[model samples]
Target: MGTIYRGGSRGALAGLRRPHLHPVPSVADRLNAERHELAGAACTAADPEVFFDGTQDATDVAKRICGGCPVRARCLWLALEHGEAFGIFGGLTADERRRLRRKGVSAA
Candidate 1:
């Protein structure tokens, strides 16, 4: 049988890499994380493609869904703060969000 030895020294750990420490989550990360826990959020049940499709028809449909969304404000704020340049968020297209940002709108 091979010999088994025990030592109090940390020499065995010398070649092991230290655990990587992640930085604090950004605002986008926190928003998205909380979004999942949000009850009655409109987008939870809808197809994701509706928001990403660039067609006007899709935009109309997405906007309609967001019209009465309980969390629309938060959704819009997340997209706006993160500078998301694509998709329909909180019933507004990327261009619309750009306009709002230009006008100094920080939240929904």
Candidate 2:
């Protein structure tokens, strides 16, 4: 009979080892999962440039899309709170948001 050793050859060690596995989700992963629950947002699928467009036509398109968004209120509130510097958000353009801020108007 061939001699068998406890800690045999390199091939034997590899045979005993399992494949590398993915790490478990971390806290950030959980948070991201929760946030992604809102992934079905209307704006989420729109062209990113649509919101940042400098032309009136493009901005109008973005606004129309936002007008129907279910999360428009939440989006607008966040933009207002953060003092968003540029781009269209929650159906409001940068200039509009500025005016609203100046007027002390709530995004809601």
Candidate 3:
């Protein structure tokens, strides 16, 4: 591109290397998935910080979002499964999850 001195026949970028392209397949295409478990979750479009800010306002906002989430149960199970030590998930705070764990309450 710097200098095409002999440009009588060749067009622009004629000397450039044409790299091979491999387009990435979509999630469903790759996994044969119908849809993600959290596709309809309310929190997907919300501010991510609201889930992990560790502030009362953030926790409240996150809980409100999780209140109507279709995947709330799955979210809670994942949170408890991983033994998450912080933030809000499935409308519950870390303390709430801790108490549940203390009571030997498994996600069912």
Candidate 4:
């Protein structure tokens, strides 16, 4: 006669230290962190219009600020991942980056 048994606590604990135990943050979380950091820098404005300005040239100013930002990539990744339709992230005006992402998705 033979007996078969499923693994128990030991098996679970064995995998605890595996490299995959901690997963990388999703694009959204990274983006939020970057947003928080950017906000902490005190560049955030009380009015959205002050940042957006409703013109192509104005968007460049936003990008320039983002260029100097430490978390620009994370912010951009989040904006693209979450499909944010408004506000500035990583120094890009909402509309400006949205158009860029739209083109990327469409092209892909």
The best candidate by lDDT is 1
Per-residue accuracy of model 3 over 42-105 as CA lDDT, tens digit each: 7656765666567888888888888988877877776676565655667888799999999997
All candidates' TM-scores? 0.63, 0.61, 0.62, 0.43
Higher-ranked by lDDT: 1 or 4: 1
Candidate 1, pairs of clashing residues: none
Model 1 bad stretches (over 4 Å): 1-37
For all candidates in order, the CA lDDT equals: 0.59, 0.56, 0.56, 0.46
Residue range 1-108, candidate 1, lDDT tens digits? 332222123332111111112112322232233445556777666665666567888888889988988978777776676666666667898899999999989854
The reply for model 3, stretches above 4 Å from the true place, is 1-37
Q: Worst 10-residue stretch by lDDT in candidate 3?
A: 15-24
Clash list (residue pairs), candidate 2: none
Model 3: lDDT to the true structure? 0.56
lDDT comparison, 3 vs 4, better candidate: 3
Higher-scoring candidate on lDDT, 2 or 4: 2
Query: What value does the lDDT take at residue 88 in candidate 3?
Result: 68
- Highest TM-score among the candidates is held by which one? 1
Q: What is the full ranking by TM-score, best candidate first?
A: 1, 3, 2, 4
RMSD of each: 15.4, 19.0, 17.7, 15.7
Error of 4 at 74 (Å): 0.3
Candidate 2 C-alpha lDDT tens digits along 44-106: 556655665569889889889888888777767766765556666678887898898889886
